[model samples]
Target: MQSKATTPTEYIHELPDDRKEVITKLRDTILSNLPEGFEETMNYGMLGYVVPHSKYPDGYHCDPKLPLPFINIASQKNHIGFYHMGIYSDPNLLEWFTTEYPKYVSGKLDMGKSCIRFKNMKKIPFELLGELASKMTAEQWIERYESVVKK
Candidate 1:
């Protein structure tokens, strides 16, 4: 669900009690492992980890006024959604995540191009997600983003 909350803290506080802990842990996992250049903010009505304007002045290609988004977490209608741009844009990263997913999660991966859905919150692999978050840095993401967008 899209949250109207303006800040990450507010967003978490607005979630249903059942979801608060999972989202908090997910947010914590991402924050603890993400590279130094990414800044946390509320984006697209979700908790977002972005490469801020200070680090990449050009901002997002779709909307230069906003910072470049790298990752986002949200509580969807029926699942918790974790969106990672790196895994979506980079084929090798996608392959790696797909291959490694089974090691951490017993059930088949429920995923879209960039969004991974966790229906059974108990099965969410925070460590693997953290590792995924750590896989790419802001500079690498910018380079990857530019390459794909420029293509």
Candidate 2:
């Protein structure tokens, strides 16, 4: 769900009481596992981690005025959305996730190219999420993103 909250703290504060604990845990996991150069903030009404313009001056190809996005977390209408940009653009990464996720998950895995939606918090695989989040630094992500854009 698009949130009106402008800050991560505000976002957490406004989350539904029932959903608060899980989201907090997920947020903490993301922060703890996040790569060194990605800054966390609110973007597109979601919790966004981006490679700031100072790091990649070209900014996002889609929107040059904005920083390059690496990942996002959102509370949608009925589920939580976890996005991993690396998996979306790299076939190898996507394959790795598809191959490995089943070992940790038993419930239905509803996922898109970059988005994994979870209705039940218990269904989330924190270990996998942490691994994915920490796999690359902002510089590496920028190189990967640029390489794909060139292709």
Candidate 3:
């Protein structure tokens, strides 16, 4: 990914006209409710709210390099996606999101270990997204993610 010392403003400035409006709204909702120490960055060509490893170096028992987690906003060929790390690692969180995201669950949503992909911005619940973002620290979320994957 092209890294340019991403700032929230810089990331927003890079978006296309159509995407700028949507991404800006997403950025606003996330920053307004973000927890302390969370940072705005650009990773993998997307806007990432990173909780850097230095912030929680001792939190992970296994992979120390797997820094803290935060939500991400990405622009793709077809649409924009919002990713939530908790969904992949936390069973409780996944179960909750699975139930919460039924409308998009069937064959539309694409996910990796902890990402929720959306083609349309409105498909996600902004309030619920904020709630998820607020619930776990980067360390806590990573530990849970590592633990779940180990099983």
Q: When superposed on Cα atoms, how far off is each prediction in RMSD?
A: 0.9, 1.3, 3.8
Per-model C-alpha lDDT, please? 0.95, 0.87, 0.67
lDDT of 2 at 44: 82
Q: Write the per-residue lDDT of candidate 3 for residues 39-140, one digit (tens) a residue.
A: 777655678877676676643344556445457777666766777766665778877766766543345546666666667655656666666677777557
Ranking by lDDT: 1, 2, 3
Q: What stretches of model 2 exceed 4 Å from their correct place?
A: none
User: In candidate 1, residue 83 scores what lDDT?
Assistant: 98
TM-score of candidate 2 against the unseen true structure: 0.94
lDDT (tens digit, per residue) of candidate 2 on 38-122: 9998878988999998888998887788888888998888898998888998888888888888999996679998999998877
Best by TM-score: 1
Residue 100 error for model 3, in Å?
1.8
Off by over 4 Å in 1: none
TM-score of each: 0.97, 0.94, 0.72
TM-score, ranked from best to worst: 1, 2, 3
48-117 per-residue lDDT for model 1 (tens digits): 9999999999999888899999999999999999999999899999999999999998988999999999
